[model samples]
Target: MTPPDLAQRLAVRERPPGRPVMKQRWSRLLFLHWRVDPDLLRPLLPPGLHLDLHEGAAWLGVVPFRMERVRPVLLPAVPGLSWFLELNVRIYCHDDHGRPGVWFLSLDCNQPVAVELARNLFLLPYQHARMRYGGELAATRYHCMRHGEEAEAVYEYGPAPSAEVRNAEPGSLEFFLLERYLLFSQGRGGKLYSGQVNHTPYPWVPADCGKWSTLPVKWDGLPEPQGAPESALWVDHVDVHIFPLRRLE
Candidate 1:
């Protein structure tokens, strides 16, 4: 199997044009987690990766409204008892041409079920992804996370190919822009949001990132896929509406 070539793939080379200089053409990630699973935990986290899901209970992230303005939304900072948040992250190495390389999931908790879902999200044996010159690149839906704080997840995914499982398909996915809308009660914060699928441009991202936003949703009904086992399972998705979405202007 093509074990992820972290060294070769992540090695930073001179910035190529059309891509960001030093760091460019990548996606920004922001996930919130409280309790975590053993298998789904990272040794360390990257900085500048934080979300405030306290004040405004937004559906997705800071959904930009005007152009450079965005509203404030609170993130679930409470641990245990009734707080669960997860978001699988994907940052691309944008290029004038060809495909980008990136993948990850972020969420709260470190439960066994959550770990399993995260594992399945990014990992795909051998399926080394290779994108043609011109074609769709993103995926359809985000990782459907189940269980946790008992909240429904409503999220979406842009068309972007990964190095492993769930790569590009036949047709191209399309995204919409909700520059002006309502989020919970934060009121139209005079910001803007442009949704793009399959064709979302890549921004600049750091390779050796300290903190990340990718996380996974676990199964509460099933007894930790390890020591014991059961049936029932809960699923989740990228609920951008839950959190406030803002453009990185």
Candidate 2:
């Protein structure tokens, strides 16, 4: 399938009008992506989404980040319930309307309440995991292991260099990976749904990695990632507003 037009994709950045249902901050994110054949990902998607490709290659990402101050729109953040660590194995896809978004294979978080809420309300594949984060700004370490499973990943990363910090050029691979504003998921009773989140374009920087592993992807039923990632990026922070999920009729 032809990739969505770059200009059209980039044009959909405006926040959908209305009060958002949720608010949160995603910080210290490490994005690791690998290029794969589109055919390998087709069957895994739900009924209404088409695998989104860039330059004819499908991309899968493993993102580990700190999730903070997550709460419903009008509610105050509750201590233990509001913050946690998250690791997701995701792929790029576009819905029937040609709106590109993420399709999560699994979202593992340290908070069980958040896992249950996401699984039941958003129809996402969320799992409870034991997770931790430490180290300093220049170098950070992340680790997670899903309950009752061998799925886990451990890695440390830091910024690439001063020269490598820049915005993603429009239509570039970096833009394709980091600019997504929508997410698609399969809801209860096999219904397909989409949710929107708005955030400023990521202040992306090339990143260097140490002691990385692809166990999360393997746990999602895909083959182990081969070789080094085609892209590794770090975004220090992005505050996000999440709209309510809507059924795709």
| Candidate with the greatest lDDT versus the true structure | 2
* Location of the lowest summed lDDT over 10 successive residues in candidate 2: 1-10
Best by TM-score: 2
Off by over 4 Å in 1: 1-139, 157-249
lDDT tens digits, residue span 152-235, model 2? 689899777574567788889999999988888886678898889998999988877876779888878799889989899999
Q: For model 1, what is the error of residue 84's alpha carbon versus the real structure, in angstroms, after optimal superposition?
A: 20
Candidate 2 regions with alpha-carbon error over 4 angstroms: none
| Cα misplacement distance, residue 239 of candidate 2 (Å) | 0.3
RMSD score of candidate 2 (Å): 1.4
User: lDDT values of the candidates?
Assistant: 0.22, 0.88
Candidate 2, residue 237: how far the Cα is off, in Å: 0.3
C-alpha displacement of 38 in model 1, angstroms? 28
